[model samples]
Target: MSKAKPLSDAQPTQRKGAPLPTDPGQTGYGAPPPAPLPGAPSTPLTGTRQRGGARPVGWNSPSSRRPPQFTDTTPAAPVRRLPQPVLVSAAVVGVVALIGAAILGYRAMDTFDTVANPLANPSAKQTEVPLAPPRPTVTVTATPVPDAVRVKQNGLYKAGKVAAVNCTAPAVKPSTEAAALRFYQAILPCLNRAWAPLVRKAGYEFRPPKVVLWAKGQTSCTGEPTDVAFYCGDAETITMRGDQDSKLFRQDATSGRIHAMDTLAHEYGHHVQMLTNILISSSSRKGWAKTEPAKLEESRRLELQASCLGAAFLGANKTALGITGQRLETWEWQTKHSGDEYNPKKVRDHGSRKNNWLWSGASFKTTNPASCNTFTAPAAKVS
Candidate 1:
């Protein structure tokens, strides 16, 4: 009792078996040490505490006590990733967009190919789609073949039928060269009238031949000396050797006139051959022959056909040309004399006498151009 010291400054007495202050600031045996001032460094806790003004080993100073830190040890639920349905929906959208683009590109390409390339789609069916303004149909017509060309291919020999010739005998006689030329000139119109229709019917162009009366001159065609009478297809002219044929006129006046007429008719037959393309066809065949015999046979056929054609003309115009039975016989005899049999040593170009007489007589008897198809006749007949 020293007057109990002022309680504020009192020092408490320890008591046995009494509870000690639980506050950490109390310096009791079991109490924790006081914390250090704020902002001071912290000390790690140990098992033991220091004695006599020393702090406990585990005590943290006030300076080291920082604001309460949130460590987030619970791990914040792992940021809850996007919902499963949303993620799946996004992936599906991306795939659908890619497929749609691919389909659109394929359709565009198909349309372009269909429009640009028809052959590219070989398997495409025409029936699938109707074409606008349907494709046009084309029609072709063949050209008509000419009769001359047909004859070369062994077609109808006489392309068409000949009509009857209406003519009258000319008054001019062949007693002299002047008379013979005048007689020939007078008969030309009749011959033209007789043959023109037949040639036109046969699909050939007809032109009356030009006549040339020469004396010992060369022919325009073969440059051969004009002996008696010849048809030159090169100049399309009939050359008559007035000097040579006039001797026949002196021998027998009436017979010479007939001979002259016969000669003109025979030479005109060559003109018919020319217009009918017979000479061209025969020459081509002759040049292609491999042997002399074949060439001779072809030549005989050509000459015999010409003789036949001559007889056809003479027979058709018998009344106008003064061709009586006697004159016809004489004409046939002339053809016989022109045969290769007359001179066996020469090439047998003109046929045998018998064949020549047969063809000429056939023409005189029938008076048909169709009867003059020597090209189709047998070798024996042509020979």
Candidate 2:
């Protein structure tokens, strides 16, 4: 150009009016220049802004990259829990204990019988041997005595009939008389039957004794207000003051028909003695009014034997009279009357309670009069 300017001077000296073009490739001293930004088009190098700019690598550019920015808030940490190893170990121990308990439970069912052969160890076995094919227990119930059966055995005689007495004229019973009359009536057939055999076999005259039921503290068999109710051999009649017959009737009736039957049967027993003429004391031919101890003792024997006779009568007729309502009444009466004999302290002695019970039980077991004979029994064994 203008006289082909000298190489150095023509390139740089007079360039104040215009800007020089950049030699991007050679500007970095052999390092390659950076490429243009992604959206920029290819063009001459000059002072141009980049689309989304990156800084130039020069003294003015920052040397260190900025650190990443952070917010002030922090996230919460998770809660800690029991260690898995400890939990697993405890679960394993529980399973082992459960299995052990199950094993022990199975063993306890056989009564804890560890012995293999129970028969081989006699000492170890229980004394009560367990029965094979166990049998049902059989319970025996006593049958009840019946009135018809009593009639067949001892006749119509009531056990305590000798204890009655008449108080008023005509010796009739008061309105309370129904029970006593019925009682006597009930005993008639039974006494007739009982004494018939004895009278025919022994050749003894049979005469039923009269019964007098009157109130106590009124005129009575002894002619005074005595509580005594007894058979009067002198009058050939039984006198029962109101205190006794009324009480008996009320008690027997309230106790029920069956109990009344027993009481009637007991009274009738005295009639049996009278017909047999056995009631009069051998020591006192006149009667029981004598003060002799022997006479009193004889009275007691008669009373007791009559009680046994009553039981015998019941046992013999258990199937006939149908002692149903108060089935146990006869048994109770027999047991009660047994003790009326030989008691010195008692106003009227028949027998001891033990004797009453014994003779009654004996008579039922053995109908023979000999079984009821207490006179021959040892003093200690009699009752």
Best by lDDT: 1
Q: How many backbone clashes does candidate 2 have?
A: 42
- Worst 10-residue lDDT window, candidate 2: 5-14
lDDT of 1 by residue, 230-330 (tens): 66676778877555445666775655666667667767777877776777777777888899999988878777777777777778778666778776666
Model 2: runs farther than 4 Å from truth?
1-175, 215-229, 240-259, 282-297, 324-326, 333-348, 381-383
lDDT of 2 by residue, 1-383 (tens): 00001111110000365643445443322232445456554552343332333334443333223222233234435567889999999999999999999889987665555476567553455659776897899999999544223322333232312111111111223225555555555555664565456554544566666765544245544464443444555665655433334444355543333333444455555555555455433213326345655444554555666666656666666545554345555456535543434233343445466666777677755654555554445544432
Report the number of the highest-TM-score candidate: 1
Cα lDDT, model 2, residue 128: 91
Q: Look at candidate 2 and tell me the lDDT of residue 84.
A: 98
TM-score, prediction 1: 0.57
**C-alpha RMSD by candidate, in order:** 42.4, 46.0
